[model samples]
Target chain A: SQQGEEDPQALSIQEGENATMNCSYKTSINNLQWYRQNSGRGLVHLILIRSNEREKHSGRLRVTLDTSKKSSSLLITASRAADTASYFCATPYVISYGKLTFGQGTILTVHP
Target chain B: EPEVTQTPSHQVTQMGQEVILRCVPISNHLYFYWYRQILGQKVEFLVSFYNNEISEKSEIFDDQFSVERPDGSNFTLKIRSTKLEDSAMYFCASRGRLRDSYEQYFGPGTRLTVT
Candidate 1:
């Protein structure tokens, strides 16, 4: 399976603090994406880092991809209470018609 | 910004009954997909549709599952017979036709409870 596995299943932090989540996958991938999901809500795309690209950033979210290690990380700088959500790492297979394989996700809780 | 929309935010039905979940993907998008996530489980892919036909489907999408674009705007997933294990949050997603556009926008999801 090409499913990504995320570490630190859950994390809790205070507002203004930085939070980092890591993901490791088994096989090669075309790109890795990060998505945020609030409880019982739809997934919101955050960022996508191609295999050739080592890092990418969007606003407060920073994503890093290391193809050599088959791992990726997401960092949210200065998180706020509203930032609390489950962060998932997903990879799309070149042959899967853009269908995404998602990880277990990291549950983030930012306290005010 | 266009987004996918699904009907019946929550549905409860008896096992063995047929259920059809409906979705209207982003207007300009050409590819559509279905995914499900059981409570506390990873989201799993079910099927992908393009050009009004199934492009690809996962093993989970068996004979019991079928997808159709009944009209120009609506996409539907029908389960022949629902089992207790079929209960889950089903999400509909879509992406633009651009070759490089791989981002899939998802709907809020329909929570199906099979009793």
Candidate 2:
């Protein structure tokens, strides 16, 4: 089952602008992770936020989790054209230790 | 930096035929996973392997699907009978060890086409 579902199926922004994507899951999660994928390429792990942690950051990426609301968001500040890709949120099932359920993903196109 | 690797970037098979997708995870990683994504669809988890046995599997991982660590470095996902609906991009992932901050590294993925 697909637990996480990203909003704004697609997004487009100019270079240097900020881009934000949101994801909502249907059940409890121990942690939520964000990943990026280039066209026809493998997924790249970006940042992960545990259920106890409200927020986390790495480089230009900022991820926030609202466990109470079962929602999370990924923000890319000062986005560059190179950041163009699909972003997905993944979470392991509450009862399944290592099985990761991924979101539908948001396609972001950073225009130069 | 060690990274996971997969073989036969693309595989084309006829329906009902058997197919195997191979992956070589990071040398020191202990957990291995298999996932698949249909074109323009979300990535779905199939199964996870640890201690040379399956730790957990998703509903999508039916009896037709099986995983094996044929050698020290090779992890493979075999489909007993391929179906046209089985066509998708299969990905292999691995993580170093169990920890609060562990992250899974993914391979380039093998594009499977079943006719």
Q: What are the TM values for chain B, all candidates?
A: 0.98, 0.97
Docking class of 2: high
lDDT of 1 by residue, B1-115 (tens): 7879998899999999999999999999999999999999999999999998999999999999999999889999999999999999999999998978999999999999999
Which model scores highest in TM-score?
A: 1
Badly placed stretches (over 4 Å) of model 2 are none
Model 1 complex DockQ against the native: 0.90
- Winning candidate number (DockQ): 1
TM-score to native of every candidate shown? 0.98, 0.96
Where does model 1 exceed 4 Å of error? Answer: none
List the RMSD of every prediction in angstroms: 0.8, 1.3
Best by lDDT: 1
What is each predicted model's overall lDDT from 0 to 1? 0.93, 0.91
Tell me how far the alpha carbon of residue B50 in candidate 2 is from the true structure, in angstroms, after superposition: 1.0
- Give the least accurate 10-residue stretch of model 2 chain B, judged by summed lDDT: B95-104
